[model samples]
Target: MALKQYMKTLSCPPGCNLLLDTSRFDNANSKLVDVLVNLKRIGQVSVPNTDENYAKIRQIIGNTINDPSVNKDLIIAAIMKTDAIRKRRGNSARNRSGLGDVFGGMDTGMDYGMDYEQYSKEKVTNKDFQANFTVDIEKEEKIFGDKSFGETLKDAEKLGAANNDITSIFPTAKTEEKSFEESCPKTDIHCAYVAYMENYANSLLNFKDFTQFDGKWMIARDKIAAALLHLKSSYKGKEVMQPNLDNFKNVCRKFVFLCGTKANRERSELVKSAIFIASEARADKDDLEIHLTDLFGEVKASPTISKDAAVQNRMLGADYADSVRITGSWRSLGIPSRVNGAESAIDYIREDNDVHSMHAAWHQINNQREPRDRKRERFFYFHNHMLLRIATERASNGLPAVQPMSNDVLHMEFSTEYNIRPENDPEGILDDYNSPPKTCRLTRNTQETLRNELRDLVRYKGLGMERFGHHCEQNYHADLHNLLMKDCDVGMLGYFAVSARPPIFYRIHSEINRVWHDFYSNQRYRRQDIYPPYGLTIRGITLHSRCGRVNQAETFWEKLGTHYKLNHQNFIFRIRLYNWRRLREKVIVRIFMGPQNARLENYFEMDRFVHQLDGNRLSEIRRYDKDSSFVFVKDQNDCGWPYHLMLPKGGDKRPIKYRLLVFVNDVHDQRVNVGTHPSLNNPMCGSNRQNMQNAGLELVDDRRDYGFPTNRRWTFNPVPIVNNRDRYFGYMSSIVNIVHTGEETDFCNQAYFR
Candidate 1:
């Protein structure tokens, strides 16, 4: 109460006083307590000033102050109950009770109703969470680093002139003497880079705000804290240490904890790390400068050099005149597929006189190639290359580089205005990705599966296949190739191209890889809250789609409908959209379940877009307006651009990592039976087995019927421990060469994930 009284009695600043107006003072009850708490936090220990602050509060509470020592709890509670003091203060509009933080705006009291108890139960430990961030004590030792030892001695000389304490931490330095300017940091980036890394450093104290220590977010914070503490302790215990270094390390650690606990030391240390490079340059008498490089032009023929070698090459200077390079020779990092695929692709593309191959590397190299084909490989190459690039970029940004020391090759393929934005299309309706930023590798089985589905559609219905410019009886087929997929030795866990076009549906691959960089990174090292970070095994992808325009030249409504059945029980939350030309202008989103190709499905939800013929106010659209969006329609639009969004996980979910498309119209089951043989037009055709009947398509004995690869853990030998101690970062159960000894042991960092 006295704190509030002191605050009000003190005159506020002339202007910029937003809280004390008429409307504000009317709601003063909410403001008094908040103001009192803030004032006590900055300074002013006792209610002792009159003309200054706390003058009135002293007079009012003088009697109480003289009696005895008062605790903060009584003071805070008494202040909040002060009605007379409350009316003097103002400003009330809070977002919600429990939502806002109570002290210093740190949300410790309440959060978004997260199940803390459940989260804590699920936490694994520090060793399991090691894959999350790099926490090395040697790295954090930089906290004690400040000015050169020589500069510190000069500052000591200046301080030595004054009366100094005989018994100090740096007694030897005090005796030796130093100057002020000399003691100050010189060529020391510690202070200069503190603010740069503060936000990241503070994230380590995430526990102060969030009650729930979800393993990933928690370990990432604790390991950093551990690293900082180790640095601090080392600095303090140095018997012959500089006092300046100890103070610097302490302050640096404090500021870091103030920001957020979820930041990594690698990012925080980068600026200082660069400064070290600059220091090295000064020592070497080289150019005292560093320049960030920009990348452009085709990258498939990228100049061959390691990352470090690339940096050195830049330092030495090289003219990449008339050259094309792909940023990296490989898409993946250390995984099996990455290593294998990189080697395979390199050999294929490196063949001499493959000049035309540079333009489109993925399609022609992976599958069939024909210049006259309608669904041209070049078109597919450009589109898929775009997907590959985008996915790779996202992956590169989020996760650390596995091939940190390797040089990336230049990309040979190029796309004009490389984007899939709907505005640039000749047809307002979208099409398959011609050039995506990144591409995913598919299994031979998945590729063949799609082919069979398309073949069956072409053979039985004939109509849907006809629209795609393909025929079965006469033998002419659309120049068909597997959709946007790159071949790799280290393949993906699962990648499905869910186009409503032919048998281009299910894609279940083996290995740890992804098209979108986001998932690609996820497959490697994601901060998954439940399991320890290691490997991701994708089961399969259910590709569903629907043609929105409904302008298919060959519409076989009946037989096509029967062929679209999915026996997989995970089918729900299906929606389809169609742009009815005859209908008045309207934006609509429809939801449906059951068969993906059901003819008589109910339109769950739709909203008319145009109130008047056109209005400026209605031009802008929010994400909630699902009608105009490319999703909710059968599409070749199964590409993840600017962002890789997770398929619907119902309400609260870890995102359906795989994609699923729900389509309408008949792109399947030909009415006439055509013999499965080499026809006049159909030169490259294969029939798959019929037992694996998905929809009405007759599967051919092609390459798409293989099981996905698994990381065999049973081959590892048992980690025998005579003393019943569990090792950190241990993999006992089902390890390839490691045997399991089920043991009960206590763990310190058990709350984090490995």
Candidate 2:
């Protein structure tokens, strides 16, 4: 008998009427109905959705029907007499029970174990069916019975105990201790010092109410010193201890100055004591000479200060303010997320104050304890990348490129009566460069003071390349930031709030880079500076994408409004070597991109790295955009450039043409061992400072000046430079056209190669 006729003849519950609806299942597949009818005839047995029952039912369905259109849910529902047969009404909840309950709420289109599409395309064997549907007790036993699992459990317990021990060290006041525990991560080695600072900041909030004024600051200084000593004792023999301790001391002194009164001739004793404390806390001879620079403004200065350069610049001009304001609500920024291989955008800001507070916390937790050099390098890299990202975002929105702040802008004079201020300064106390409020004239004098310092630094031209790089980087960059920001509030240009959130930060760093270029432009490499023995030569270059080999690609906006999605592509560089002397050699590969007609100075750095190459007569080196050394792995603490911002938005109608340059140079530094595990392939955003230091490595161990060749002005035209037949420096340049597609693309869906 036909299945419909047979189903009509059976006198069952009204819910069973849904089984007669052919729309729900294939008409040709009557075996599923026959099996359910047999189960009903035998007596309705409730089958719970246990793993064993699910496996058994799935196996029976697979054996009976080869048709993909057969609905497995109907079979399970009929056998178990589930409530799933009841009509769904207006997104209402189902009152399903047992095996039907599990299948009722789920997406019926999806296969529980095997892929639905693959199952439809190929025949399934009994072995394959069991492998897909049944759970293996032996595999579970192997994993749970392994020795490593036991060790992992023991380590987890130890970590828990360590967390408990750390929490116990906080102040005994319940509310304060709870706040500290919530604010700080227990696993962080520097959690103790962070807790101490939290308490110190809280204590300073009530400083005015204290009756005793005598030697109060001195007592606070001693407490900080004692904390440092304790930290040293607790983490003795640890490589990261000293670096973290030094960072703690630096931040502590800054906190004191910000939270304390300004120094003056009348309070000479306080000023002298502060200086003494700063000197005593110095970790090395080259540590910041805090005394030489006036942290606080002149005596009788107001506590309140102007906004940071970012906010101040916006206030100075309506055009700049509108430029940023139009991008989106100033209160919120969209961050992208990837889950189950699908991409979605989420807004992280819940309040207006969240902007500064969230960034402050991120910087504090991620960067406050890094080694001094790594911290400084990260600062530069972060600012530079942020400037590029901002420029790219603006371009995508049909705005002009971000203009670099000219030297004259920094030299511009202001009246003493200028009265612009920020709405709030939540992170002011954490600023290491806190200064007493100053008049506009005093601010101009600070600029002149910085100029004189730079002049003096440049006058002594006898400095070697290494020393020159250090002085130019350490002394000049730090002093420029401090002097430029001295008159502003703690949150203005301080560590806590100097992120790319402000548009003016990009301008300020643009000026800094200009100065850097001026210093390093003339320091070009001689022929002997680069090794020539390897005899490397560039053959040709090819670009590949998911759609196949292509010379042009597209970058589109993500559904999440804030970011642009980069095309997934790889660069294949074919090279040939004539004289292979060693088994292998380490080489540095530098990649850069710029507008086709733009000057060399206008180019943006894509990536630079130290890589190892096997000794062969010919080879092809392939690199992916996602694996660029410039990016950090997507994680909570990542501060590296977003991989999405790798390419700027191209023209809407005609594609924008860009020149891609790749430079290969030999590594001379013997301390660098590139072949070690966790190799230097992605070393730009370092893994961990402690781990790297323990291995006797810096964040970037390459002794060469960062952004070499391009750092200096070797030529006006890059074509000739790449076309040169220099054996020591082999370079290749290619043209890439970027098209702007005004649509959203899922970042995870892009084609990626291993």
Q: Which stretches of candidate 1 lie over 4 Å from their true place?
A: 1-55, 59-77, 80-85, 88-305, 308-581, 585-754
Instruction: Please give, for residues 1-754, the per-residue lDDT of candidate 1 as tens digits.
Output: 5453443433331121111122332234234444542334423455321233432442344234222233222232224233123322332112232221322233333322122232234212222210111111111221122444355445433333222331221122224333312332211222222332344444544433221112233244333333332222221221111112232332333232322232433333222222222222121112212111100011122112234433443455632221122122222111111112222232211111121122222211112221133232223223332323323222322432122100121122211112223332323222423433333344456456545644454334423322322232112111122222233211110111112111111121100011111111223211121121122111111222121211100101011111110011111122222222222232211111111221111111111111111222122222222332212111111111111111111111111111121111111132212122211011111111111121244322211101100101112221221111223212111100110111111221211111
- Per-model C-alpha lDDT, please? 0.23, 0.39
Query: What's the TM-score of each model vs. the native?
Result: 0.20, 0.47
* Cα lDDT tens digits for candidate 2, 1-754: 2332333334432222122332332232234444432333323444543445434553444343223333333343343221111111121123222222243222223222322233344321222221112111111122222245456345333322223231221112222312334323322224433434445434643433221112343354344444443222212211112322233343333333223323322122232233333333333312333321123222111112123423543675633222232222221212211111111111111111223332332233222223344443444444454445454445444446544444455555431121122223222332332322333323667667666667766753465444544455445555544454444432244333323233334555676566556666566665445334346665445444443445465554432222223332333332333434533777766677776655655566777655576777667666666666655443211234445556665555346777776666677674464324332333333444433443465544665555555556552434455544543445466676665444433332222210
Overall local distance difference test of candidate 2: 0.39
> What shift in Å separates residue 132 of candidate 2 from its native position after superposition?
54
The candidate that wins on TM-score is 2
